[model samples]
Structures are given as C-alpha cells and as structure tokens.
Target: MNRSSCAIVYNGNLGSEKFLIQVRWLERTAREHGLHVQVIGNQELIPGIVDGSPVIKGRYEGQEPDFFLFWDKDIRLARHLEKMGFPLYNRASCIELCDDKIRTYEQLLNEGLRLPKTLIAPLIYETCEGIDERPYETIVQELGFPMVVKEAFGSFGEQVHLVRGWEELLPLVHRLKHRPHLFQELVKSSYGRDIRLQVVGDKVVAAMMRKSEHDFRANVTAGGRMAPYEPSEREREVAVTCARLLGADFAGVDLLFGEDGEPYVCEVNSNAHFKNIHDCTGVDVAARMLEHIMSKER
Candidate 1:
C-alpha cells in the first residue's frame, strides 16, 4: 500500500489569523485521511538570488510532491510546480482568473454568464497628474449613481465600494487611479445580501446566505451574518457553471439576486476561505477538497 501526500501553499505576508485558521483546519483534516501535509509559504518555493532565478532552495529543494492543495494566489509558483509535473487543485490559470475581478468578469461575460453590467476603469499612468474625469462622467451617465466600485485585486470585501455619485466616485478614482478596477451597475436587489454556494468539483457541497443590515457588502468578514441556504435549481446551475467555466476544482461562488429573483454571478473565489461556511453550515469544505485533490491525482 502507498500513502498519498501533498503540499499546501500559502502567502507569507497575508498569513493573518483567518489564514492560519484555514491552514490549521486543512492540516488537521488531511491528517485524518492518512496523508502527509506540509504547509509551506510561497517564498519557500522561490529563492532570492542576486538576479531573479528559479532556484529551489527551500522546503521542496530537489523533489516535488504528488499533488498540491494550493490555497495561495501565487500563480507563478503554482505554475512552476505544475511545470514540475505536480498536479495542483484548481490549477494556476484558475487562480489567476479569480484573483482579478476585471479578468474574471471578462471571462464570465465571454461565457455568457448573467452578471452585473461592469465597465473596466481606464488605466491611468503613474506619471499622470490626475484621471480625466470626463470618461467616468459619461460612464456614470449610463451606470447612474450608486454604482459598485471594485479594485481588481482585493478580498474580504475591503476594496469594494458603493459610489453614490461624482462626489464619492471621483475620490475613489483618484485614489485607485494607478490600480486596476471596474465600475459595475449596482444590483440594488442584492444590496446588503447574497448567496454563497460552495462547489467542489461539479457538486455544491455547502451553501449559505450572507446579509448585512448596515453595509452594502455582505462578506462575512464585513460583519455580515450567514445562514444555511438551499439554492434553487437555477441558482445551483449558475454557480456550478461559473466554477466549471473557470476550471476550478473547488470554488466559493457568490450569486446576487436580480429584481425578479434571477441569479447572477457576483464573484467566484478559486481558493475561498471555507471556515466561515463550515461554521455556519457545518459542512467541512477542506475535507471535501482533499478528497477532490486525491481523486484527481489518482
């Protein structure tokens, strides 16, 4: 008999309390399944030499694991492992797609998935004095006031904002001028509320409804409360299809409600934290993900 083993890769800088909690849960769960789990940071795989080079001098010096339970957004390192012939759950491309909201929306739109009408903000160079507000003025004329402003690279609902008008929108534009972001038509029906369906492979393993009475964003980290949710067939299909199109082994799919109760893809997290969902619904996502990875490797 052979033992199955794998690695869990994470980012070193953003290893906060929640991140550590997720790591511990994964480590403990993997142990129960008779697997060797090595929790390593992205730095361990990429060395710091005088000139940038792909030299492995850290945890995985000369050998690669059978597979990886990748939970980080370090796409380069994830791709490096894939090049070494190690199968990664969710894969690098999936992570890359989910890491950027603009890119994710572009792909989702290309796939004909129903989603909020989003417009990518124009790129303003670093040397520019300030963004030309005329373009946004015209865009706002269409999207109207109270649009959703999202930084392409953000998480836990930190960079999401509800821009009411030019007063609020201009400040955000100046602040995030050099960064990649998008302006989305606000889903008033889904404001302060949404549904999260955790999909592992092709099946939705767990789900919960998140709502905030005081805030526009409903992320649990944003002080929103979660309740066990049973999505309708259409909702389930939308969530599952988004995950499949993104090529995710597992994903936390956030679906927003339209005026008529129609479901639209809000976001897809390739490596979404599952502890909150587990706490809310008592469905262990880590264990399921482990099983998914092992089954795929086999």
Candidate 2:
C-alpha cells in the first residue's frame, strides 16, 4: 500500500480491439489521480491448487498491487485475488452473477425487483448428444413465439436471439442446449429500445435511451443509436438500486419498459463499455470510475 497501484485483470481470450482501448483509457485515467495501473490478463496467472488450497500460481512472485480493477468475467481469478486480500472493485460474486443473465434476473427478482417473466433453460452437458424439444413446449406456451432467447454468458447482444417461430427455436435450443440460457417474454413496449444508466456511488451519472429501428436489440454495439435521455425519478431509483443490490462499485444497468410503462431490470454489466456513452454524452466515464475506486482506496 506504499505506492498507489492497481491491477486491471482483463480477459485475454477476447480479441476485441475495444478491450485494449478500454485498458488504455483506464490506465490514463488512473494516472490522472496519481494511481499507477497495470493491465493484466487472466491468462498471465495460472490458477492451481497448492497443498489442497486454491492459490494463484506465482502470485507472490509478481508485483502485487494495492487494488484490483477487474475488467474481465473470470470469477476464479477474481476470487483468488480476493483470497489474497487484494481489494477488488465490484467483487467476484457480483461479476459472476452479472455475467450470467439467468442469475442476474434471479438475484434481482429475489430482491423484489420487477423483471419480465423469464424461464431458465434446462442444463445440457456438452457431452450429451442433444436435447429433446418436449420441454420447449412450456417455453413456447408461456412466452410464445418471437420471444427472446438470451444465453447466460454473453455481451453486446451477440448471444441474444429473437425466435420468431417454433422452427427457429428448436435448432437454437439444440445448438445451445449445452450452454446455459433463458427465455423471457418480449417486452413489446420496449421492443427495439431500452435505457442504459451508468451508476456510480449512489448517483446516475449518465443516461441514454438506445433504440434500433432495424433490430430488436438496442445495444449500440448492435447498431443502435444512443440519445441522451433524462430518466424519470423511478428509472433513476431502479438503476441505482440495481447497482447497490448487486454490490457493484459501478455498472451499466440496462432497464426495459414494461407494458405498464414501469421500468424493469434488463441486465447489468460489471465491466460496462463506456466508449459509446462517452461518444454520445461526452462524459468521461473512465475518469469517474477511477475516481470512485480511488475513493474506496482512501
């Protein structure tokens, strides 16, 4: 703790160039606050068991920083750092829960938060040949065709699908049976639209309404356009509460409009990409995040 230093654990498996840019922004922002930051990929440190205890291989051999700014969804590495007593922003549990869409909905629902009716898909091991379509009948009957099928672990709406017919669904289910997923009733009111609220330290710092006329997913990464939107008092309340409930130091909370115009939790991003927000709102989210982390360090 003598020198201000942080390690941003990022995912090396992801090849997105934007991830690299995110690291650069974070490093530059941390410097603004006089904190030295290093970007470390998960692959750099191999996890192993030593004497029947989980330990990071060669963890002590390297420069152990005072803080961990986890930018990856590698829960095991985050947990290992936590066990090593390094302060981690957002924490491993929160990142894990937020990484899995099904878990996020479940946890939020259990917290008495409103969400679109969602059904978890049955688990299918990768070793299994495939899955039967019988159980999907309940899914079809409950949510109907044109429902949303979201993979448990995904980002930027890449693994999210809009099943418009039974024919399209069976193959998707068969293809994704081995992976965890969920079916959610389509929020028609929010179809091709949603809101992204960036929450930090009890404040909704930036808000945007993402809309896509050509696609169902409103993610800017999904070709949606973002416009600065003023959230209603209730929207702000929901977004802030969602972040607090997840124990997130900062997060991008997506909210959907229910049929009755009520806001429901759509998803939470522990490592939310703020480049789009900066483009639209002209707000430097990286600076704010760095400031929030520095506050915790103090």
Candidate 3:
C-alpha cells in the first residue's frame, strides 16, 4: 500500500484560528489514513531572497508532493502551483472568483439562482466625487430600511454591517466608500441564520445551520453557534450547482432562508472552514477531503 503525499498551502500564522484547527485535523487525519502531509505558509513563499538568492529557486527543493490542498488565505499561490504539475483543490480561478462577494453574486445570478438584491460600487474615499450623490436615504428608499453593507473582499464576517436606518447607513457608507462595498437587501425575517453546505467532489459531505444571536451575520467566526441540519432537497441541489458553477472541487455554499421562505444563496466559499461543520455533524470532513484526494490520485 503506497501512501499518498499531500501539502496544504495556507497562512496559518496570520491568526486564522479556524484554519489552524482544520489544518491540524487534516494533518492528523491524513497521518492516520497512511498519508504524508506537509503544511506550508503562503508568506514564507512570497517573492523574497533566502541567503541572497532567489527564494523560488530552491523553495520547493526536494519537496515533491502528490496533491496540493490550497486552502484559504493562500489563494494567490494556486496559479503558481499549477505550473508545477500539482493538482490544486478548488483551483486558483475558483478561489479568486468565490472570494469576491460581487463576483460570486454575479456568477450565482448568471446561473439563475436567487440571491439578495445587491448594489456594488467602487471603493469609497473622501476625494472621490459623487460620494454623496448616492445617499443613504436613496439606498434605503430603493432597497429598504434595513440593509447590509459588505466589503467587496472580506471574510469570516469581519466586514459585514447591518444598516437599520439612514443614520447608520450614512456613516457606514462614508467609512467604507473608499474600500469597494456592496449594499444588499437584508433578509430580516430569516432571524440572522443561514445554512452552510459543504461539498466535496460533487457530493454534499456535511451541512450545518449557523445562527448568530446578536448579529445579523451568521458566520461561525462571528460568534454564531452551529447545529447539525440536513439540507433540503432544493438546498442540496443549489449547493452542488453553485460549486459546479464556480468550478470548485470543494466549497461551502451559504444559503439564507428569505422572507418568502425560499433559500437564496448569499455566497460561495472555495476554502471554507470545516471544523465547525465536522463538530456539528460528526462528518469527518477532513477525512472525506483526503479520500477525495486519494481517489483523484488513483
């Protein structure tokens, strides 16, 4: 029995508590399954010189692996790995496309999936003209009183803001104007909860319901609690569709139950965290991911 070799590309030192936990689990699971695994940081492989020589020259020296698991935060390095003949899970384009909220929305819409009414604008800055032309009052009148303001490239619920009225929207718009934001209709009736369906190789490996008690965003990282939940037939279909549409080998589809009681995809995460889903569902997501890798190798 030949053991498969794997490498996980990530930036764990950047305080990704969730990612660290998942990677540790992946390492343990892989070892237990008779696989060799190595964890490499993205920052350690950036354009730099080691001992006054090009870093890339000997960076991967004597380190050839069978599969490359390019996790979150190392998305930018996927393309480089492609040239090395290593199979990257989710691929670079999928990670890049799914990371941008606006792009993900557009792709989902193109697939004829239901999502929130969204408006994306250029980054806001003090010197930018027409900043006030699109006032908060105008946005509220168009979208509604309660809305969501999200940074174009934010993750882990760090850059999501719920605007209840004009007063809140104005300050938030002004603050995030220079940083590329999107205004979306808030799914108020959903009660600050959403479904996360984890897909690996066209199969729904694990699913969970995340509900935030205090915040509108229901990300597990945003102080949300997770519970095991079986996805509806529609949810499973759309979750698989979203991953396929984005060409992701593995992904997490976030679907919110709307006021109309229908599931609307909010976003797709190419390198989604699996620890919470695993804990909530007892699915052994890391082991499933390793199994997928091994099968692909075969």
Cα error, candidate 3, residue 22 (Å): 1.4
| Local error of candidate 1 at residue 83 (angstroms) | 1.6
Clashing pairs in 1: none
lDDT of 1: 0.86
- Model 3 alpha-carbon drift over 4 Å, by segment: 1-3, 15-17, 47-55, 123-130, 135-138
Q: Write the per-residue lDDT of candidate 1 for residues 45-107, one digit (tens) a residue.
A: 874333444445765786566778888998888887776677888799999999999888877
Q: What are the clash counts of all predictions, listed in order? A: 0, 0, 4
TM-score of 2: 0.94
Residue range 1-298, candidate 2, lDDT tens digits:
3489887777878777888888788878887888776777789877777787766665444567889888888888889878877889879999998998887877787666789889999987788895777889988999987899999998899999999998899888888888899998888889999999999888899989999999999998889999999999989999988888888999999999877868878999988999989988998888898888888789
True-vs-predicted CA distance for residue 86, candidate 1, Å? 1.3
> Compared with the true structure, what per-residue lDDT tens digits does model 3 show for residues 256-296?
99676678888888888887887899888777877887788
- Go through the candidates in order and give each one's C-alpha lDDT: 0.86, 0.87, 0.79
Model 2, runs deviating above 4 Å:
49-55, 58-62
